[model samples]
Target chain A: MLCSDSDLPAPPQEALDALCLRGARLLSGPVWAAAEVALAAPVVEAVALQGGRIEVFLRTPAAPDEALCGVLEDSADLEAALNVLWSGIDAILPEDTARTADATRRGP
Target chain B: MGDLDRLNSKLAKLKGKDDGQIRASATDSIVSALLTEIEETILPREMILTNESGNRFVLVVAGRRLLALSGHGAEEEGSEGREDAAARIIAVFRGPFRTFLDNAREISIDAARPPNRIDPTMIGCSVETLTAALVGPGQASVADPVAAACDLAVAGLRLVGGDVVGRSGDAAHLARLEQFAGVGGAGLGQLAGDDTDAPCCVFLSDAGREDAILARIAFRGAAALILAPPEARAELIALCREPIPAAG
Candidate 1:
């Protein structure tokens, strides 16, 4: 359930819940979430959720000096935004032995 | 002498020297000459990014580094103004090229990090794809997809005298771009002969080394060469003034 009062609309609450769930799913895997994740892997540096809108701050290792922003109106738009973020992370992540091992264990 | 004439003479003089020596000499002369021209032609006001605090950051796109001013401020504290500021900044920078954000409010700015570096892929596409993604579907302003793509890629780069070369569809050539993964400028030379159909973009980092490097890649049919510091625009334009004869 989204961390909102009972008065909030269902669609927006559902969308926020989905976004958090997605973040949680990523955490369940090899990835971990923290402000420090910006130090290494691409991570969500900041997020703003309010009034049925979701905004994400993405810092990528490829260009550490910059952050990319993505906004989603509701749960319907969350997947596309997530896809953009994940694609960028994949682009920068090293394709080395350890990464390969982790990915292999994670499976498709 | 005319700019092209002077450049030709310089190239002629570099003919007999070692390949590295000639390239270094040519690059230096070109950069020196162009810096003067850039200052006189392009106004500084045109490049300034005017927002709230007037903070400047380095934006690197397609290998070119540009000084971008912060146009939005996270005023009012909390997250209320943060994402809006980021969206405004991105919209301002990308607006000139007709790129639009689907959900500007969904974007957030990581104020904790210095806003200098920009990874082109962060938007989930190559510089090329980002350009296309921003375009609204059924837009009548864009008639030719290939030309539009090339224009999009070049526009994304904050280059002064930069121009796209080779094929415009190169941006759509993803298989070729994959080869550049994890490789910086050092490993770029190895990509010379890999795929004839593949297209790539170039940006000159240093003055001395770039002449030879640019020449070599130009010979290999790279898509574009962006002169950095914006001061090198004059020289880069002159060096690339004539179409390089494709490698035999």
Candidate 2:
């Protein structure tokens, strides 16, 4: 769903989930599926992890440096594997930024 | 000269030294040349990513591995049992290009693992098909072969010049392009031949002088290719994220 133009920092994961669920109720399997997958890796985190659910809280918006939020359960046994995956994610981020920025300036 | 034009020249010069159809086996030189130019010249300094949109997706990638991360829609699962999920992800993005790769005109494979080894099977369909598949269906496709060529030209032109730029058959060919708005002084040049017909070129502004001129020829459409500078790559990627219409 399109966000309002209030310049709000992306709300915490919990809040985002609420919004996503509220707008497109869970009965809609496709929308629910997309949200579930999208939440796994984030450029930023609005929600802190609690027992089983993640707590959503708005973070201070980054001005110059943007943060990505990835949602992996704190319960995973593969901390080492998760760390490596994060490293790969971090590695390509700069590339992604540059490419996206370049595309924007060139304007197709 | 505009940033785009300069890279074009470098790519052309890079390819000049390579003799094709039968060169001693080594890393695919053209792939290496393109990747190197992108890493060294186009990514050193830039904000590369922006938050223009609330969401974030990869803006660029450098590794030879075509990376993928897949799992279930809601339930977390191990890689062992997610083949279906992986297939679904690829199905959404991959298009006609799969056919092209299955039946490529050329297939170069390297059994030995070297740093720059490329699986010939990875080559997508024609450049056009690959671009469209990656960008998305219904999204307008722009063929900036000139920019792609420019990247090669910048590397090639920088490494080798003179005789290579002059010859028509295998050497190189330079061609001029019509003027456009912000792209005023810019033009395109190409280097091509029968055996290794990799098209390469440069985009140059009127104010910019060629580092080396090609000997005049019939100019049967040989545009230049060179490496794109960092800033230009960032700019180009950003433009790619425009919101797609619901229909598209």
Candidate 3:
């Protein structure tokens, strides 16, 4: 469930689980079947994998020469992957309003 | 399995105890005492204070967490002594209190500014009876002291009535931790620049668990704690006051 724009409580663990499940559905066939939880402070996101392949990529796909392909695989290995995505998004693009856009594009 | 079970157990415990098991007043006294101890023992600096709707606040350095000082005042008491009490409390923050003071600068900005919109120093929630209130009416005995302190800091932030704020680097949280840690400004800035280890720092506010969660992310560490109940905060601060060497 989406946290309301107003006040919110800690994301219920169930909600986090549901988020993971939803993320798993977005990737194509033969994708890794599980989700790993990651935290980005007030927000939490998941990283999806298929076999050994990591699915995260930058929103502004760089030209072959201009792109900065950060280490997405180990970006947030210990915690959730969405948090890592958010931080990268924030650093590359500090616009606060783009949080949802960044989160949606990079979701599992 | 143990980690999974622990997570499950913690989630299960969150099910009940929703009567807002926090005694607003009791929490206030404890936070007040902890700040008193910090002033008396740690860093003694002068304080700038203001009050609105019965809550009180003291401004510190530019980037430090706004310290909230509370006390159980005598209702039957007259105003003549209240000023003196305020003076004593202000005095508590004075004298050789360290660089937390040196970093002070007048931003000349109102408390309503964008970042200050979520005032870091304000104890956003009531602390009076947090112990009796949070641990469930029947299970106060089982309240984990560490959890309770973290609860108090979060509660303090919320009580002051601010939005839940979090970011890659929470400027105020970083500033306050630096000041509280007594690290020089340049040194503290450099430490913040070092993203090698998970950062950890305690927050004191009137907000609730949300703030604690924010602190946890802000200070990514194995044991990131946010203490709210004054007694709980005191214990955590005591631990923080320990000598973990920079070399070790």
C-alpha lDDT of residue A71 in model 2:
35
lDDT of 3 at B219: 23
Question: For candidate 3, lDDT tens digit of each residue in B23-113?
Answer: 1122222233333323332222223322222333343322222233322232223133544433333333322221122222211111222
Order of quality (lDDT): 1, 3, 2
Between the candidate structures 1 and 2, which one is better when assessed by lDDT? 1
lDDT of 3 at A106: 82
TM-score result, candidate 1: 0.18
Candidate 3 deviant stretches above 4 angstroms: A1-108, B1-79, B82-149, B152-199, B202-248
Docking class of 3: incorrect
Off by over 4 Å in 1: A11-17, A26-28, A31-42, A46-108, B1-248
The TM-scores of all predictions, comma-separated, are 0.18, 0.18, 0.19
Candidate 2 residue spans exceeding 4 A from truth: A1-108, B1-87, B91-132, B138-199, B206-248
Best by DockQ: 3
Compared with the true structure, what per-residue lDDT tens digits does model 1 show for residues B115-155?
A: 34544433211322323323335432232222222333322
Clash count, candidate 2: 91
Tens digits of per-residue lDDT, candidate 1, A47-105, equal 33323334454544334433445444422233345456656654444466337635665
Clashing residue pairs in candidate 1 (N, C-alpha, C atoms within 3 angstroms): A55-B106, A65-B117, A70-B106, A70-B107, A71-B106, A71-B107, B51-B71
lDDT (C-alpha, whole model) for all candidates? 0.31, 0.27, 0.28
Q: Give a tens-digit lDDT track for model 3, residues A1-108.
A: 222223545557785554444333322111111100011121122222222123332223221111112222211232234335445654554354356446756885
